[model samples]
Target: MPIRLASRSLPLLLGLLLALPTSLHAQQPTAVIAAEASLESWYDPLEALGTLRADESVTLSATVTDTIAELNFHDGESVEAGQLLVRLSDNEAQADLRAAQALRDERRNTVNRLAQLQSRNLAPRGDLEDAQAQLRQAEAEIQALEARLSDYRIHAPFAGQVGFRDVSVGALVSPGTELVTLDKLDVMKLDFTLPELALGQLEPGLPLTATSAAYPDTRFEGEIDSIGTRVDPVTRSVTVRALLDNTEDRLRPGMLISVVVNRAPRQTLVIPEAALIPEGHRQFVLTLDPADEHRVTRREIRIGARREGEVEVLDGLNEGQLVVAHGTERVRDGQPTRLLGILDETTSVPELLRRGRDEAEASG
Candidate 1:
């Protein structure tokens, strides 16, 4: 009888446990999740690498062979147009010019005397003509000598900053020898290469932006100046050039730069990056259905470009749908979910703190 009573009591206790109120059970609040639907108006950009170079660069050279007598300009000096840069030894040239002038004067006198004789019939016609020819030849010779004397001096062809001088004062320089380099850096060029697939997208005057590691925070703006006519066979890429304003002179030639090509504006569906779930070769997200009492459902979506903290959804999603941004792994498809609060309407803790500080200052 005692054993039967114990068995009955055990069955009764188990029944009581099963019949207990749900409130009496160990109950915890369901996990709260956040979500946002994909929306349009996401900006996608193409990035490339490039180098900055001076827009105009040239090597200054001697046009005539001569001894450098005086170097009027120093290395790395800013010179104005037509400024005298160097002077060669001009003693021999000056003497030659003087001799030519004297011969020209002598010929002039002979020609005048012959003309007088011809008028009086005291000289032959051929003699008078010969004197006239000699005067003409002498005049031509003087002009040629004067031109040669002008080559003894060198002047700046354009207004620009000069580079290091290769020849010094009293240094003999031959024709075509490099003296210095000149460059105009007020505006610069950014040269970069793009893949062959991007060739169709390139066009003149397209807006471009670039930044250098030296100045990471500052962005330089420019536009496509030109595109190469042929693609490089080895790299299968085409060269592109952009013109950037360097009025501040902060950017220098040969500086490595990162380029961003601003393609056509596009409107694409975008969602918070946190909502995406990657699994092998597929990506998915959890969405809430309001009509079905906020039931969570999993959805596969095609992702496009990502910028900032948002990602563009190319397909498999639409606007006005709620996606799970947090606590996604805990939920299942078609499962009933009780929203603790509207996740999309919530702001970050840092943002809230900043706003509170701003409000306090305003009130004070």
Candidate 2:
């Protein structure tokens, strides 16, 4: 009975021994995506959300207290510099102007009469001098009245689009009354803030690109017009202003925009975002030895900004090195690996899974 049991156990042991190599090979980390670290012209742009405003804006107001007699400008109309928009009642001012003009005319006649008498020596010199002084005084009064009358008409201070006015014809308005809004829309000003830690990168004339959700396809180009002199104590940030060309008048004032400033660029080592593996506070990645692609090992890398699906490798990595981008979880230090192909970060997961399946089928 003992000899019969040994024969049965031997066949089972041989069958289990044959399956060991297959199971071990299947468990090895399959590198379906191997990305090479290289020097990429990376953009380390600082980004922030900001508001867009007219390059020049103002609210037109009544300069003097008076009743609005006429509204010359329609709502939302383009106005040129010095174009009349509103007219205040000038009945009393006009009457005073007429009186001044009549007095001036009378004084001029008297002055002419006095000059004629003086030339002929028929009138006293003192009387002629008195008449001339009165004539000059009347002329000054006329000039003053004319200037006061001009104030009744309100003209556009600059070339811009005029907003609607709350007051209409016959409405009583006073100095500083809200009449309308004017905005120069040929160019736009964008104000944004960035952290104080980025002070070193702030400068005038930096190139910027701005976008808005209202016009997603449109990208407005601009540049840094100025930088704030002081940093905000509460936020530890500095304000920056950019000027964007709005000749088309597509950018509206008070609209929010996303800003990206082009910082000083340099070629640096970079890797795919998926290659980074966070282990506690440190990051880990699997790199293959050039001579032995199958010999994979874990390596730590210092990373900076992750933009456009690529990670900026600040340190702990070298250019032209190969790393496992996909199937990273299955990889460990001193593990077996198979280099499939160069897989970009944009590659879909289904494609990677299909590649892994094909490799597994071919190996089997």
Candidate 3:
């Protein structure tokens, strides 16, 4: 009986030992992460989705009705201005030109003969005038035929890269038929739309920056070339165009890109997103006192636009003030916090907040 009683007590003792540590740990305070503030320039960039397009684009088409005799340019070939791209059946044009020349030659011979006769007083004045008129008419006909012959050969209108050829050799095409597409891509155009509120800030020649998903690390700079005079009633946005040098031709048309337009520069404060704590509809953060390294105070911040893991604090924060970065949720107002190593604390809050607010207001 004594052995059985001891076994039952042993099981109960083990259970109590397991539960005690959990309860004790639950009651203990958790370590909170903290950050120190420093003054540095911060940018609250306005971001928008855009597409890359060629500065000059056109579709090549035939100017006259004819059957294609030869296709000079291959698909996706770079061509120069005035380069021959297509050849049409010129046999008929050549024959017509020859006929016109023959008629002109006969008329010229008659005019010469009549002029000599009139000089000798052997021909009537009316006859000489008729011969001269006939010569002039023949010359005009020849010039017209020559112009028609020139149309049989199609030339490039501008220096650009050619797209796929639409017509093949021996294909019959008319004036309106598409032959190929030509695009000048040495310079590219980036087009994006901005909110109507930004219309006041937007102007031609404003500096802008852009990035593409294909080359995210690389940044391209440009300036606003034009702004839409009228805003779209449905979207309430205005179109903006920026011209960028794409000499390398790395950027292609229709590629999606992100645009950032800098309107003006001002000073503001900025912070990281991890430092913010949201309670209900309001936002707050844990701020540390410079005098006391451990004492933290809950600061209610008027937040603005957020991007790239960072947040802009419009109010309730100041430059050079330490703010808790990590472990914000565990921190309470006036709680003592352990200062971990400051991670990227070198940023101004005021300038960041102002820029963020401007962008948000523009978007709204």
Using TM-score as the measure, which candidate wins?
Answer: 1
lDDT of 2 by residue, 251-299 (tens): 8899999999888766888888988899898988888886875678888
Instruction: Note the residue pairs that clash in candidate 1.
Output: 34-325, 35-323
Candidates' lDDT values, in order? 0.80, 0.85, 0.81
lDDT by residue (tens digit), candidate 1, 40-100: 6544477999988888887877777778898877777878878888888889889988998
TM-score of each: 0.66, 0.64, 0.64
> Listing every candidate in turn, what is its Cα RMSD in Å to the true structure after a full C-alpha superposition?
7.1, 6.0, 12.0
Candidate 1 runs further than 4 Å off? 1-44, 115-125, 265-304, 310-349, 353-364
Output the TM-score of candidate 1: 0.66
Off by over 4 Å in 2: 1-42, 124-129, 265-306, 310-364
Residue-by-residue lDDT tens digits, candidate 3, 143-262: 998898888888888999999976789999999888888999999999899999887777788788898889989999888899978899999999988998898888899999899987
Q: Higher-lDDT candidate among 2 and 3? A: 2
Q: Which of candidates 1 and 3 is the stronger one according to TM-score?
A: 1
